[model samples]
Target: MNAEVRVNAVFSDHMVLQREATIPVWGTGLDGMVVKLQFHGKQTEAVVANGCWRADLPAEKAGGPYELIIEAGNQLIVFRDVLIGDVWLAGGQSNMQWSLAQTDHAQAEIVDSHIPDFRFYDVPRVSYEDGIVHSPSWKVCTPEHAGAFSAVAYYFAKGIITELGIPIGIIGCNWGGTSIACWVSEQVLTHDDDLRIYADEYNEQIENFDWDVFAAKEAHYKEQIAEYDRRFAAGLREKELGDFPAAPMNPHYFLRPFGLYSTMLLTVVPFALKGVLFYQGESDAHRPLIYDKLLTAMISHWRTIWHHSMLPFLFVQLPAFGNGGNANGKEWPLLRESQLIVTEQVPYTGMVVALDCGDLEDIHPTNKKPVGERLALLALERVYEQPVESSGPVYKDYLIDHNKIILHFDHTGNGLEARGNQLIGFEIADETNEYVSAQAVIEGATVEVWSDQIVNPLAVRYGWANYTEANLVNSFGLPAGPFRTKREERQ
Candidate 1:
């Protein structure tokens, strides 16, 4: 009598299941075996077919500490301290994975992080074709573990907890410096003409990779890391260590299409989720032209996989970085502009402007508190029907009159105001398409921009450069994101 029944490793003792959703509890059992699941005083059963079985538990409200029991003939499994609440998937690059210990005010935040309703599940960094090879189960949020947990996720969950008072589960599946291509499937890449190049390039790179050279590069990177640690120990902030050195190539691990997705995302599928908090785009800055398309494609594809076409996607727009001597010298600003396009064009999507939180020297900003809370504001307002402002002023429409261009914006929380005495970072261009510094002033919720040099202003740009210290913001103290009012034909 082989009556052994096993559930996915994700089904841990302290897991938080999505509230008000049909819970899909699946596992593998012997052929023709009947598996029964009991939770919240209800029982459901399923017959094993082809070595797999699933029981759909009825939807539950946002309250729990209930025990779940699974039985199959002589085999039985019990899970305690189960929670029913909002479960959010946190995904992206290094910024999304930036732990609390790495951020500002970490010591105080971590010391106070003793919320029992908050749970975390960090996916092991590994890529596989089949599924998650090593599953690290859910952990109860504590002061000790919170220090290593994703700062953005922790703060975001904290904000939601303060408002909703419900258990929150943040599942982190992020890889530092990974591109959006690494998260999507190969089929998604090959299906799109513009994105197919990434797949093709990875295929060629993998085929021609030299393991010996890669090993040498890895060794060199290790030495650099050691030196960096030594410098940090000598009372120097890690941010002062300057740019992180690029590591050796791992085509199959971080470069291949759907590499991280196949291993990290696939194993967690069919698990009900409230939404996704994404903070990527730094790695894709170089490909700014097609970023909006790629981002929309990723969101659409992810929704399809999750079987929730209306899944809410909240993302952080890239912030100001290194100096751009001129408008054309940097790719980051263009990427920021493209991010705005995705936020506006894509349905059920939100973008949090992080222009004010950027560090001029270091790419990873330490002020993750605002970024997290703003994302929570979006979810609270749009998803939970809470009355709150989730965004700064967003450019809506522009009207050109004589030499002046008046720009109108939305989400003006308590009207707009310049951070300093005078509005800055405004530029105007003529028919020649050469932008020059422009005088700008806030007139109600609209900004009037003009330049004496450009008699017939053809286009107007605000905070359009890579590292302009823009001062325009709403009353909420949230900085207005970058915007360019140039028509494609003019460029």
Candidate 2:
């Protein structure tokens, strides 16, 4: 370890370099120092300027247990057990950050999770750049280590490996209870009228930020959390424990707009990758209408940073959740609609529907396997050119025929069918915009809906609630996502 020479924190032993792509190895060193990198008998060099050095190794095929040796003056660094393979970045909030040990069938999955070629690199969660203490290294998938990996990422990698037999590396870059605003750059937030509110509000809060006041509040909040944990471990009821303490807002707060982009995402930029897998939107449910714009801008910003204009971006639509009542809440359905809009408008992007995999009372669904596997299916079909049905039936168009509203959909794999005894969760709206429950029947590749109470149906919506037993599915058994038709009221 030489003080004058250092490698970027992202590279380490057991790391997987993206195969068949130019491998970039960068570091900092004394000015004018010549840094050299050697891997698989291929050598490259760069001169350090402004205390930074970068060397690009020629592309190699997927297969390695090789040593990467770097030499700068007298100091030498060697990273061993490196593999060349496909690498993907898993980015989003809580559902994407959920751990394997917390998911369903965790015990069995952990026991069987011994894939030497599969690896993970969890980006350390830090609110600010200065808060980063140490460089987190990559880990090989094993029974002992797999429990801590992101369950969605683990299952996704497993699915890809089973299909391609190539080494897979997943970089977990996510946080729990985070908004889409937290991941995008500040410049992106400031430019858009609808998105500027997030940045403006954060700036207002931090303008008068006082370190002493924030520290005191944080200390108290920590104490309250410890007490709540102790009571829960002692079998105390949640009602007796009272509500969880809220953290004080500050410049370093994790939820602050652009905080994670500076701290978490920037650390792994320019690292070659296969693509990205995102699972988010729960936090943005309150303002669902603007999500399509926010997400599209964020995707473009990320691709710009990575210098890959067509990077594959696959995401999960928010699953059904009661949000503490009967599953018929409204905000989440709107957010899911926004997600669908992004997938339709953005190129090289896909969305996975999780309408049938939600909990009535719990927000974090434990069935992450389906979510992850669906993402893999999208990658297989769109990225790898494999023949796979990656999506469920998606709303395409509607035909108003007298009193009935007929709905047409794309990706109706084999055809649509109700998952239960009868089709449920359909509603029809009249010219006055008054909506009532309607009966729906599957007809060929389309669904026909009508209600005796409404003669002229102006609009129709299905699975339009926070949570619903929307039993509509394709022949592939994949559930159709929430959707609504746009129609104008008669004057």
Candidate 3:
């Protein structure tokens, strides 16, 4: 084995590389072989280090179906079907992490998709670090394999390939049922005073907690929750909302705040990507006030670490989950506002509305195409400089006309069109907490709203419940996400 040479990013036949930038090509080699990379008539060289060699190839403009030959002395290896194009990192929670196989039309989608130009690089679905694994192999797009990948990511890649007509690579690194905090770095957490307080405490707790006892307690809680679910399903309200309360609804992924963020920051955020696509907020809904700060911190922290100022990040507000319960929808509203605040605080960030894309009964919506597609649209318009209309009727401005409220919008590209029928789930409330059906008319750039009962309307809220018939879409046919804007901020 003295004269043998080995390579990684080697097993794959067709490799995708991002063009117009210096791509780091690194691997192990003989002690003094002088490893060289040859592609598209250009050759780059590097010296071996501890039996390894790495070099930054001069940036090449996108265009190619080329061959790459890596040589270490006389030992040579050739990687075929190399293409240079756009690479995107698709991340976030279950909505973003949902595989094509789980969506409504999985079978049909997977069967029809066979574009070979699109490739996927799945970072092992791990939240913790095993250190940096040097680049995963890119998988070619095929029906049998596409279904196993993230539905949102697959579709997004497909869209990009269809439009750009170039090789596209998607990096899917998302963990389901995880929160924003879990994806942050411990170093950053330690740096932030607002976060360090809890991080220190969590560290102490982890060190002191009796693992056996904690595990048993968690198991007990799960068992108890299961019993409550059985009771609730049997038409029993005895312990439905009363017994469970809020804390026990879901198991805490990070029993303490700042724990998750710190861990992911170091382990997950190393890859160089154009931007981020976020889909979360269901877990942090309860602490809406704090969420604004938390979200702002995460965005800032990510940009700072990546050293990319003004990175484009698109997020989705929480979709309606849990079978149409009596949830006042307070959390959802607060979280939406938090999302809005993030955009206002962080530059180049956008959001997608999913009010009409939720399951009335189940929390995880079966359709993920819209979520990912809308994200790509934002990228197309803002990132890729492609012409595309990618937003619904957004709450723009509000005018107080005596006791009436006139709500305006910005991106109603083709004007607002309520899906399938009437404008539902809109309520106008006065100073007193009393509310009633509000009359609304979509005209020009505004939706004039009012209710006779509240002639001096102080607030206007749309779809502020777990289950409200709210399907207001713009001419572009995207549903308006759930939101509430009052004359004064109540949340």
Candidate 4:
């Protein structure tokens, strides 16, 4: 007899299925065998073709502690404690991967994190297609396992479950220090002119890839990493620890463009999802000019693969960071502009403003509770159709009235207000294209910006730097993100 039928590893005990959506149960099985799936008083079947089969169960309402049974050729697989609810995929870089145990107030959060309905599934961090890896399983929210869950995802789910009282499943699909290029498909990257550069660079890097050479380098890298870990555990300061080890850029390298798309993302495709929560872009900030187009293409490609034309994609706007060096550089500001552009142009998408939640010196800020809760607010307002103020004041348009510029804004819940006594981070530029600090005052629903030095102010910008102390916010306490009226010539 051929091998027994197997359901995808994503389907396991304590798993939460997307409620009110067709739940696709898929796996590999013997060729020409019949596979059947039964759940919630519904039955579906598909014949195995090319060693694969899929049976989609009918949608159900948001309540379940049911069992899922699959049978193929006398082989039976049963998964218990399955819940029907909204499922979300959390995708991004280090901030999204930062575990709950490493976040602020972790001990208290973990102690209170015993919501049985909320669950998490961490996709294994596989870099290469042929790399042997263990299958990941779902974990119920408990003090023991919640500590290891993504802090951002945890808080987001907690907020949702608190309000809606429904099971919320989060599929953690993220890696630290990875560019958006690593998560998108090769076909999509190669098809675009600007994006082709990533593919070209990747091809060049792996053209002479050698397993033997890679093995030797990896051994050395591991040793160095071990020593670094020892020193870090020994309480050495980060600056005193010296440079961290860099892995060899071989074919199996994790940072290789399109590598995670094949190894990590593909493994979770077609899985039912309410939407995607993205928090990346730090690695791609150096090339801010192309980030908007790159992110738009990535969202479209992901939606296509999941077969959801208007799949909701809510992403975090890159937060304030000084990069441990220059805090005034325009690269980060430009990247934030690109992110805002994507939200403006793309439909069924939202962005969470984290300007106030960022750290001035640390790239990885410890205050993730606000970031995750803000994301939950967006999902509630945009996706779940809840009555919530999800965003702060966003710049709408501007008018030049002689020496002063009148700026309008939207989403100013109630009205916009400077968090402190006075507004800061506002600058005006004359025809000379030189920006100087300007005085801004909230005027009813709009803000008036002016500088005595510039009689003919041609442009205005707010919080236009890699790191800023912008105090503008709405009555709800959400901060307005950085913005500029026009593209700077130097940028």
Candidate 5:
């Protein structure tokens, strides 16, 4: 007799199955035992193939709290407290991983999580040797369970729950201090020459480091322990900061990019989900130019592996943070532009504009409900198709007329309105290419721009800064995205 029954541990009570799509239910059983799955008025059955049986259950329309019963051999696994609705994968670094406990209304939110149906299944972080991952099942959302879930995912789901009234399942797979490259596949990194150079250099660093030599260095210091201890205690606060290069060059800091992705994403994460909600880029803010290619590769790699085209892949745009120069603050204008480029190139992709919600001092913004809520708004309208539009006003195009530059925007449902009474950050340029403060006034549905200094304006920009208090908003109450027209304003 062989022990034969395994369901990915992530599937548990209160899991939300995808509505209106082929649902795959699999587990191990007797070599040829017939597995029966009965859910939502459909009974599907399949024979155990190589001791693993998978039943493709017919699609169910968006609605449930229904039961899912699986029977095989002498074992019967019954999943209670289930629901049918939208499920999305929320992934990224600390921002995406930030817990509800860290948010503003955590106490109230956690207590309220005991609500009937919303669910989130968290997968443990584990790295692997291959590109394919098989992770465990999920945990339903409850007050006790909600304490540890991601705040970004939770708020996003809350917005969906209030609007859709259907159970929402969030698959959270995030890690703090993670890089975009680490989520990309090895093949993509190897294929691109620019990225390959970084990979080769990284592997070389790991290859050349001698751990024995490192140990010897530590051992050598052990002999002079008394002196070392005196120096460490007396006035060596600098050493406490940690040294990057111990033996002329650091070993751990130089590991290959995506080396961890191959190790973790493939080994620990499961591939089935409606789509991905990604928020990363703080690590690569310095290389804002390369950030585009890095993210594009990461998204493309995952989509190829999952075999889903036009998967509703959404991401949070980089929010404002740092005091001034760190992460190339002013340079971020270009990076945000690069993100727009990816959205332009890729279909079924949307960006959650967080430029307005950033806190200047702290890198991690505390007001997270809005961030999660905004992303959910996009998902609901675009992915769930709820009865509402989901976006701040977006810049569409512009017109140059004499000393005035007329701006046009998209999805200005009912028209544009400033959050405050006045517009604060619009800039216009003269033939000299010099930018001067431009005045903005709503002319019916478009914004008319002009500046005293820019008597012959050629281009214009709005709220395009590392820190700003732009009041531009659409009738939807969503702010307008930072934007600029590309003609040589002064030249």
Candidate 6:
């Protein structure tokens, strides 16, 4: 005798399956039992093996309010009101996980969030050593649900719905303030010198830390969260709530090495995804020098796991905060530079520059609408082949004539224009590596930079300072991302 048929929690009522992709439906049941699936007037069947069974539903068209029926060993499971359409996974840190209720215009947005074509599914934060755990099911977008959903994810889905006129499903699998190393396997972390420090810390914690103490704290945290949810449902203001639970400095599920990837992302591997939208890297800002390698590795690892070599990946560049200077004085700018490097080097990737949408004093900017819309633009122009202005001016190449450096750019929507009286954040440097403020002007889609102090400029940098409020942008009003050309590039 074996256990009765049980489906993976990922598949349930009100779920939206990916359109134009092989739909994998898997579950556990009695070994060798006959399993059958019936959906959308087509039936596919497979035999249970090793205590598990699977069926592949054919690629479907966009519209669906269909029912999915499964039968195995006298046990039957049915999912109703299911949809078929585009599915995207939302990954990264607090910004990606920030809820709509905490964002700007929350009240008005919630009132108008009646779109039935958009849906969201959140994978609860849980860790397992060996097996998979089911948490929550798919939720349709209503005012109540939309209020608590990820603001960035919600806006991204909304943009897609408006443009494509198809059902959109967003799987929110993110944790706030989580480091990149936590989202990757320990083995992968160990391979890179930049990431091994986190792995070593986790190993030390496992040897010395008290598991019982951690368990007690975790239990208390969950209780507090439950109480907070209750208070929030009763119309309590967020500011009125005291403080959310924070894990101790020692070992915790979200902080431990490979914790999130093993728990949150492993079970969802190989599930069909149209693309991925990531917003993280703030926690890894301390080690800015290694961020580029770490993120590149993470992307490669995920693409391999998904079996999609060229999956369309788009990410939000960290917005400005705290005058763009960390206490260490090097973290923020370096991290932003590393983000730009990935966007330029990665084959199927894009980065949304939030240069003009940052908050000077707040780490978590409440203006997430532009972040989401920018991400959607990347998908629209690059993934869907839509002819749209997806970005602002990007440095293409430069020409030097005696004392002047002329900069050429791509994606100069309409033409270039300085947001202020004159272009700020421009610097000219000579062979000595000393830089001075340069006079800059927009000439159509090109910028001419020069400084009287430096007669022969050897390099040029824009928005290279810690607290730069650059005024250079294009006609579409998207600001140019920060960049600095090295001495080698000047040749």
Question: Which prediction has the highest lDDT against the true structure?
Answer: 4
Reference-based TM-score of each model = 0.91, 0.94, 0.83, 0.94, 0.81, 0.88
* lDDT, candidates in the order shown: 0.85, 0.89, 0.71, 0.91, 0.73, 0.83
After superposing candidate 4, which stretches have Cα over 4 Å from the reference?
1-3, 131-133, 212-246, 489-491
Worst 10 residues of 5 by lDDT: 241-250
- Which digits, one per residue and each the tens of the lDDT, describe model 3 over residues 1-491? 45445664423457677777666667666687788888899889888878876676767777777888888877877888877887676767777778899998789888998988887766654333446555456678898678878887787777777777877877675666665666666665678666565467556656655657777777888887887787778877532434562232212443344444544333334344567777877656656666777777778877887677877787777766543464555666667777877776777988877767777656689888887787778778878888788788878779899877889888888688778767766889887966677877777767778888896787788877665667778888987866677523443
lDDT of 3: 0.71
Order the numbered candidates by lDDT, best leading. Answer: 4, 2, 1, 6, 5, 3
CA lDDT for candidate 1: 0.85
lDDT of 1 by residue, 27-49 (tens): 78788988999999999999999
Write candidate 2's Cα lDDT for 16-52 as tens digits: 9999889888878899999888999999999999998
In TM-score terms, candidate 3 sits at 0.83
Candidate 4 lDDT by residue in tens digits, 349-449: 99999988888767889889999999999999999999999999999899999999999999988888999899999999998889999999998779999
Off by over 4 Å in 5: 1-3, 26-55, 63-76, 127-137, 212-256, 259-264, 267-271, 323-328, 431-436, 487-491
Number of clashing pairs per prediction, in order: 0, 0, 13, 0, 16, 0
Q: How close is candidate 5 to the true structure, as a TM-score?
A: 0.81
Ten residues in sequence with the least summed lDDT for candidate 3: 245-254
Candidate 4 lDDT at 102 equals 92
Task: List where candidate 6 sits over 4 angstroms from the true fold.
Answer: 1-3, 127-135, 211-251, 323-328, 487-491
RMSD value for candidate 6:
5.3
Report the error of model 3 at residue 143, Å: 0.8
